[model samples]
Each structure stands twice: as structure tokens, then as C-alpha cells.
Target chain A: DQQVKQNSPSLSVQEGRISILNCDYTNSMFDYFLWYKKYPAEGPTFLISISSIKDKNEDGRFTVFLNKSAKHLSLHIVPSQPGDSAVYFCAASASRSNTGKLIFGQGTTLQVKP
Target chain B: DTAVSQTPKYLVTQMGNDKSIKCEQNLGHDTMYWYKQDSKKFLKIMFSYNNKELIINETVPNRFSPKSPDKAHLNLHINSLELGDSAVYFCASSLTIGTSGAYEQYFGPGTRLTVT
Candidate 1:
């Protein structure tokens, strides 16, 4: 069974618009959620992360929102730029004692067009 | 200054052959891991080691083995390679098992393994 799910396979956004990526997870033990961005032929790099305790965390242009009640998380990139085109991944980690493993979801490809 | 690095950015071999992918992390982290991404683009964990000690082993086949000779190096060896082994293999590292609740993981550029 997949613990984490990203329903959208791809998303298109106009440059300078907002791009929202959503993720859903089933594990109640998950305490940490993260977002990663990857360009073709490169590894996924950490973008931003939010702890389950917090509803939202924001970086320069990227923000991650987590709703514990819904077991859902969303990543928002505001004023998306052409350089922001890439695949975004959502990951969750449960309490570490048992496994503390970070599980990933199917990626969502984001295309920012000028 | 690559934090994490994997060798042979690409590999191509025939079925029944054997091959290995090498990984090293210079971040002085205590934990290292291997993840495989299939054609469907699903990323899954294969193995994880902490400071040369095997800590986590997922439900992977016995044909796949991970060896950590030292704190900085972790290599993966696969035997009797099958077409099903074709995928991009990634290496990653973290501070600990998130033992203290540290949850960041750094990854390396993947190795594209092609089994014909």
C-alpha cells in the first residue's frame, strides 16, 4: 500500500503565476513532511519542509502547508518562474524508533511557461 | 564540493551479468541509503547504513547487496541482473536515523542502470 500519494501527474503554470502541488498521506504516525525539486538527470534536492506541528512553513518563494486532520500537504511556489520547471516530490517520515524511514510519493511534473 | 556522489552516471549491461554502483558522501553524516526509481517513477528505499553499520534493509531481493567499507563509502552490488533491474539508482545521506528527530536527507545524482 502506498502511504503517500500525489494524484496529479503534471501541472502547467504561466510564468509569474502561482503553482500549487498537493500531496496526501495515510500514515498517522508521520511527523515530518518535505518537498523536493528535481531537474532531469539530477537528484532531488530539498526545497522546503514543515513539521506536523506547524500548519505552514515558508521560504523565499516556496511554502509548504500541512493539515494534520486531513493527512494532506501542499507546496506553493509563488510567481513561478521559467526556471522553476521541474518535478516536485512530497515525502513523509514517521516516528524514528520503529523505522524513521522517509517515504516518497509519485512525482508531479511542473512546467512553468513564459 | 559534492555533498553526495554516485559513480558511473550511466550503466548498461546484459541480463545475467553482474554490476555494482558506488556512492560516497563527504558531509560527514552518520547515515547513508540507497533508493531505486522505476520506470513508473516510483521511488523506493532499498537499503540504509549508518556509519558502516547496516541499519535498515527493505523487502528487497537477496540478489541485491549493500556494502559499506567505511563511513564515507557505500556500494551496491547486484547479481544475476535481470531486465527488471533497469532503473535509476540514487544514494542519499542523513545525520542519523532521525534518531534525534533531524529529518533532512541529502541525495546524489542518480545512476541510470540499464539491464538488457
Candidate 2:
């Protein structure tokens, strides 16, 4: 069963516009959510994360919003740039799992048209 | 320097053969993990080690064994490779055991294994 799900397989946005990527989870035990960006032939790099206690977390142009009641989270990039175009994965971790094992989504490929 | 490095970025082997993938991290982290990304783009956890001790083993088959000789190194050895085992394997390291505080993982480039 897929505990984490990214319904949109791909997304397109114009440069200087806002890009929003959505993710959902079925497991309520997950208390930590993270977003990772990946390039072709490269490993995923951490972007932003939010804990269950907080509703939103921001890092520069990137912001992540989490809704524990809905079991959903989103990654938002304002004034999206071409460099931001990459596959974005939403991952979740439950602290009780002990090993910090992350359950990752299928990933969403984002394209920014200049 | 590469924080996390994996040797033999690509490996191609025949079915029933044995293969090994080596991973090492220089970040002085306490935990290491092995994740497999399959054709469907699903990243699944295979194994995890903490401070040279096995911590978590997912539902992976018994043919796959993970060995951590030390805190900085974790290796995966597959016996009797199967065609279904063709996937990209990634090695990652974190600062702590749980996902709290500076626990963001650093991942290696990844090793693609193809079983024919």
C-alpha cells in the first residue's frame, strides 16, 4: 500500500509564477514531512520540512504547508525559476519508527516555461 | 569531497550471479540507509544501520543482505540476482537515529543495477 501519494504526475508553470505541488498521506502516525528535489542521474536533495506541530515552514522562495487533520502537505515556490524545475518527492517519517525511515511519494516532475 | 559516495555507479550482471555495492559516508553521521527506486519510481527502504548495528530491515527478500563494517560504511550484497532486482539503489546518511533535529539525510548519487 502507498502510504504517501502525489496525485499529479507532472506540473507546469511559467517563470516568475508560483508553483504548488501537493501530496497526501494516509498514515496519521507520520509526524514529520519533507520535500526533496532530484535531478536526472542525481540523488535527491532536501528542500524543506515541517513538523506536525507547525502548519507552515518556509525557506527562502520555498514554503511547505502541512495539515495534520487532512493528512496533506504542499510545497510552494514563489516566482518559480527554471532552476527549480525538477522532480519533487514528498516524504514522511514517524518518530516511533526509530530509524527515521522515510516513506517517499512517486514524485512530481515540474516544468517551468520561460 | 563527496559526503556520501558509492562505488561502481552502474552494474550489469546475469541472473543467478552475485553482486555487491559499497557505500561510505564521511559526514560522521550515526545512521545509514539503503533505498531502492524501482521502475515505477517508488523509493522503498531496504535496510538501515545505526552506529555499525543493524536497526531496520524492511520487507526485502532474504537474498539481499546488508553489512555495516563500521559506522561510516554500509554495503549490500545480493545473492542470486533476479531480473526484478534491476533498480537504482541509493545510500543515505543522517545525523541521528530518529527524524528530529538535523536529521536531514545526505544521499549518494545512486548505483543502478541491471540484472539480465
Candidate 3:
């Protein structure tokens, strides 16, 4: 079973616009969530992360919001740039004691149209 | 510098053949992991190692095995490869073991394995 799910298969947004990507989880025990951006023929790179204790985390143009009760998380990029075009993945884990294993969702291809 | 690096960017072999994929991380992180991205583009965990010790081995096939000689290196070996086993394998490293759980994973470019 897929513990992490990204319902949107693809998202397109214009440059200078806000891009929002949503993800959901079936495992309530997951206390940590992360987002990774990937380019074709390249490995995924870390973007942003949030702990269960915090509802939101932001760094520069990227922001992540989590709702533990809903088992959901969303990533927002303000004034999205063409460089942001790539596949995005949402991952989660319960705790360190659970073996530091990350479960990833099916990626969502994002295209930042200029 | 490449924090996580895997050798043989591409591998193509016949079924029933055995092969291995090597991985190394220079990030000085204590933890390393292996993930497989299948034809459908879903990334799945195959194994994880911390400080040269095996930690997590997912529900992967017995034909698959992971070896870590040191904290900076983790390798994957597959015996009797199958068509279903063909996929892009990624190596990643992070600072925490169970410390931050699954906080951050820095990945390599990925090793694309194809079984004929």
C-alpha cells in the first residue's frame, strides 16, 4: 500500500505565479514530512520539510504547511520560476526509532510556463 | 561536490544474470539509503544503512541484498535479475539515523538498471 499519496499527477503554473502542490498520507504515525524536487535524468534534491510539532515551515520562496489531524501537507512556491519545473515528490516517516525509512509518493510533474 | 554518488549510470543485463550497484556518499552523514523508482515513477525504499550497519530492509526480494563496508559506502546486489527488477535505483545520505527519523535525504543521479 502507498502510505504517501500525491493526487495531482501534473501541475502547470505561469512564472511569477504561486504554485501549490498537495499531498496526503494514510499513516497517522508519520511525524515528519518532506518535499523533494527532481529533474529528468537527475536525482531528487531536498526542498523543504516540516515536523509534526509545527504547522508550517518556510525558506525563501518555498513554504510547507502540515496538518497532523488531517494527515495532509501542502507545498507552496510564490512567484514560481522556470527553474522550478520538474517532478516533485512528497515523503514521510513516523519517527527515528522506526528506522529512518522514507516512503515517497508518486511524483507530480510540475511545469512553470514562461 | 557530489554528496551521494553511484557508479554505472546505466546497466543492461539479461534475465538470470547477477549484478551489483555501488554507492558512495561524501557528505559525512551517518546514514545512507537506497530507493528504487519504478516504471510508474514511484520511489520505493529498498534498504537503509547507518554507520556501516544495515538498518532497514524493506519487503524487497531475497535476490536483492545490500552491503555497507563503511559509513560512506552502500552497495546493492541483485541475483537472477528479472524484468520487473529493472528500474532506476538511487543512493541517498542524511545526517540523522533515527535521530531526525526521515528528515533529509540527499540523492545521487541514480543508476538505471534494465533487464533484458
Against the true structure, whose DockQ is highest?
3
Clashing pairs in 1: none
The lDDT values for all models are 0.92, 0.93, 0.91
Off by over 4 Å in 2: B99-102
Question: What pairs collide in candidate 3?
Answer: none
Instruction: Report how far off residue A49 is in candidate 1 (Å).
Output: 0.7
Better of 2 and 3 by lDDT: 2
Better of 1 and 2 by DockQ: 2
- Candidate 3 per-residue lDDT, tens place, B2-115, comes to 778999899999999999999999988878899999999999988998888888888999999999999999999999999999999999988866554347889999999999
Chain B: TM-scores of all predictions: 0.95, 0.95, 0.94
In order of TM-score, best first, we have 2, 1, 3
* TM-score per candidate, chains pooled: 0.97, 0.98, 0.96
Runs with alpha carbons beyond 4 Å of true place in candidate 1: B99-101
What C-alpha lDDT does candidate 3 achieve relative to the native structure?
Answer: 0.91
- Classified by CAPRI criteria, candidate 1 counts as medium
